[model samples]
Target: MSLELYYWDGLQGRGEFVRLALEEARADYVEVVRGKSSEGLGTAAMMALMKSRDEPYPPFAPPFLKDGDLVIAQTANILFYLSPRLNLAPSVESLRYVANGLQLTIADMVTEAHDTHHPLASGLNYEDQKDAAKLRAHDFIDHRIPKFMSYFERVLKQNPAGDTFMVGDALSYVDLSMFQLIDGLLYAFPRALKRFGEHYPRLAALHDAVLVRPNIAAYLESGRRIEHNEACVFRHYPELDKAAT
Candidate 1:
């Protein structure tokens, strides 16, 4: 059965992380809400499912994946469920748990990235919280980025497989999530990232390497790879971004 991913149409948002794994695995999946009304599976269909009582437990939001009778939500949870099934994690049972741990940390980094621009309230616009955002962004560039990058760089160096992949010796879903996280940071803080890259060479290499993978490279060129914009999690606001160095 084809996997059904319920996420907003034309917006990557948190859904891109799930999409990356699916695309990398070449899994047969449909972006449910990306469809049109003529097909009876569009954004409206996704919203309906969210409120529907058909399922014993409905997701609080989009980006949930429905596979046969099982449905999973939460980015890390969805990836954890899909990783083993899609062959995007290490075959070793223990290594899959390690991959999930890395993914959960990556999710924390992603939340910090989003919070930088909306430190006060998600309901308020960036402009409304510009002061708080500047403070948050500054701290993120100086503290959070270095902290996260250092940990991941250390993971790469310590990996028994080598510094190429996040877990074990292969391209796990964690690596894909790392690539997406770096891509967003670069877009959101190009100058800041350029200044900080020298401290994490292996991490940078992993990000670049993932971009060239056959499936991923094609996805980048395809319409599925939505460009980062103001509406997305990683938004670029010039004043809120700066180089720590």
Candidate 2:
């Protein structure tokens, strides 16, 4: 497995989505940032790759996968590429697009979740825009969460193969991602989640099912699973969360 994954050293951020898929497959890959910098395969290498002009398809940021000569960036895109090869996607070619679309929708929800804390600007610290974040968070928890969570519930109900997974009969990368999304939502807005989780019973069930998977369960308990922090996406602030207040 000559796969090298480049993401931030300390935080899971978007890279964790890709990591979940790889972990589920038990794929041998190098998480560059987690390794020792002295080995010349660290965050610095990832940073250098981002600026490399020699590469044909230059990645704009971290959370990129380097598979032999092919370098792919973006969490959803990388998952779309790897899921099929790793046997983490639907066998049907057409359904692959549906899986990718769901992954992209998850990405949208992630962006909204991230902006809830850094509502004004990603360049600024959450403290700098606390007021805006409060407003953004209120709207996110009150409005956006329901919209997205309900949408996923519908997706699950209409899954054709039943709501066992996000896409097809087996667990795809999209399923792993939705589980991550639900986990993040619970962390960032536990109060809102508790109030609204029941309405999306199917989605909640999917989350529970994914959590118990042997590979996912092991990876989560293992040292590789980075805990949620204020610095990463889905920061939990007491004031920002409706239930906390």
Candidate 3:
């Protein structure tokens, strides 16, 4: 059976991380919300599953995965489960855990990125929270970005296997997520990320490397990949973006 991915339509959001992994592995999966309603794979289908009382493990939000009868929620959780099956994880058990930790950290950074624009409240609009967002975005670009990017940069530089991949000597799901994270940050903060290569050379290299992978390159060029927009986690508001320096 094909794996079912339940995520919101019209935006990359958190789901793009999972999508990146699947695309890299050339995995056969169904994007539930992106499918046609006539095929029982659309927004209504995703809602039905979410609202189903008979479900033993109900998902709290979108970006969940359904494989057979098992349901996995959360971006990191979904990637953790799929990575092994997709051969996008290390063979060593301990290293797999380390990869999971890295993925969760990426998730944390993603949340921080989201909060920059929605610092006051997720329920509030950017226009309404413009004042607080500017402050939050300033801190994000000045402090958080460097802190997180530098850590990942160090991780790559310190990797015993090599500096090319995040875990082990080969590319894993974590690498894919990192690529998406950096790509989103670049899209959302062109000014802030202008000097990314100069500071975080390892991360910059990884991002460029992932962009050229056969499957990844094809997926990116295809219509399947959704463009980042204001509605997603990484929004580019000119007033909220600035150079870290």
- Give TM-scores for every candidate, taking all chains together and pairing residue i with residue i: 0.96, 0.96, 0.98
Model 1 residue pairs with clashes? none
Please name the candidate that would achieve the greatest lDDT relative to the true structure: 3
| lDDT (Cα, tens digit) per residue for candidate 3, span 1-245 | 99999999999999999999999889999999989999998999999999998989899999999999999999999998998889999989999899999999999999999999999889988899999999999999999999999999999999999899999899999999999999999999999999999999999999999999999999999999988899999999999899888
Per-candidate Cα lDDT values, in order, are 0.89, 0.88, 0.94
Once fitted onto the true fold, the runs of candidate 1 whose alpha carbons sit more than 4 angstroms away are none
* lDDT (Cα) of model 3: 0.94
Model 2 per-residue lDDT tens digits across residues 155-228: 99998998889888988999999999989888888888885556888888888998999999999999999998
Worst 10 residues of 3 by lDDT: 236-245
- lDDT-based ranking: 3, 1, 2
Name the 10 consecutive residues with the lowest summed lDDT in model 1: 190-199
Q: Which candidate leads the pack in TM-score?
A: 3
lDDT (10s digit) by residue, model 1, range 163-223? 8999998888999999999999999998789755688999889988999999999999998
